[model samples]
Target: MPDIVSFNKGHYYLLGLGVCVGVFGLIATLEHWFSIILSEATVKKLFRVAVLGLMLGLLLPHFSHFGFSRYFQSHGYISCDAASHRWLHSVILVYTKNEMLCKELIEARK
Candidate 1:
């Protein structure tokens, strides 16, 4: 059977940090473009959102399996397993519930 894989915690944290930075940069760029100065309250709200995004990034791996499983199901494939690796990188793998179907999918890719 095929399996679904998740990344290590470090990878997720880095991704979250990147996302947080991107969000802040985007907002800053928009504000500059529109000649708008964010109030203290608005800046505080943005900071809150960034922190929340970081927290979500830390939790992303836990919920990622469900999303991948649903995507496979939508494509008429049943996910058989979800695995997390302790290696120093992130990876995504999709597997079908049936061995035959898994083999067929693998062969089709070749």
Candidate 2:
């Protein structure tokens, strides 16, 4: 059987907060190393070029399909009951719950 999953509102918030912290750390590290390695002008030019290229890549055919999931969800991909509560019970919340579960499991061994 498929693994059963449930979510609480606070859990989803924690997951997004975790991901935001991770990405913020990543960007901070990139900026720090970049300043150490290059002049201000070079870093500015490179960052502009690179981030622009990445943005354009998101518009390509292969990458375009990523938006379909959102579209389908909005268009009622499943029954109303499931669709209505999908946002409340997202993968983000499930991941956060799993993390808490793992921590509890580890502490229980003591």
Candidate 3:
């Protein structure tokens, strides 16, 4: 097993991604059930609730110390940690320019 002490930002990001994916899957399952068991209007409302919950779940990590640092780094809110900041910039910068760069960055990080 990999040492917990050896885990880095990339590992945490992967874990966060896994959690987001799991929440997405769960929301989708609930949506499916709502469609089958609820009236159309109720299904729509519940589906919206599910989607909102999923979005909040995905954003939860961004409120953490590690995630907040990375997010601020990506946005240029802080500059004390250049190395880590650059890594996060690589992840978020592509959103303003080329989406492919994010994929390349993640691949390179791996």
TM-score of each: 0.50, 0.26, 0.29
Where model 3 places Cα greater than 4 Å from the true spot, the runs are 1-36, 66-110
Give candidate 3's error at residue 90 in angstroms.
Answer: 20
Count backbone overlaps in model 2.
0
- By summed lDDT, the worst window of 10 consecutive residues in model 1 runs over 1-10
Output the TM-score of candidate 1.
Answer: 0.50
Give candidate 3's error at residue 92 in angstroms: 21
* Weakest lDDT window of 10 consecutive positions for candidate 2: 89-98
Residue 64 alpha-carbon offset, candidate 2, angstroms: 25
How would you encode candidate 3's per-residue C-alpha lDDT over 3-103 as one tens digit per residue? 11111333344554555566556556766866545467875665566666555545544554465456544653432221223355133322212334444
Residue 37's lDDT within candidate 3 is: 51
lDDT of 1 by residue, 41-78 (tens): 98888888888778777777557655766766776665
Worst 10 residues of 3 by lDDT: 1-10
Q: Note the Cα lDDT for every prediction shown.
A: 0.62, 0.41, 0.45
Ranking of all predicted structures according to TM-score, beginning with the best and ending with the worst: 1, 3, 2
Q: Each model's number of backbone clashes? A: 1, 0, 0
Expressed as tens digits, the lDDT of each residue in 6-100 for candidate 2 is 23333433444445455545556776866545557865765565555444443332333334344444543321222123343232222212344
Against the true structure, candidate 2 reaches a TM-score of 0.26
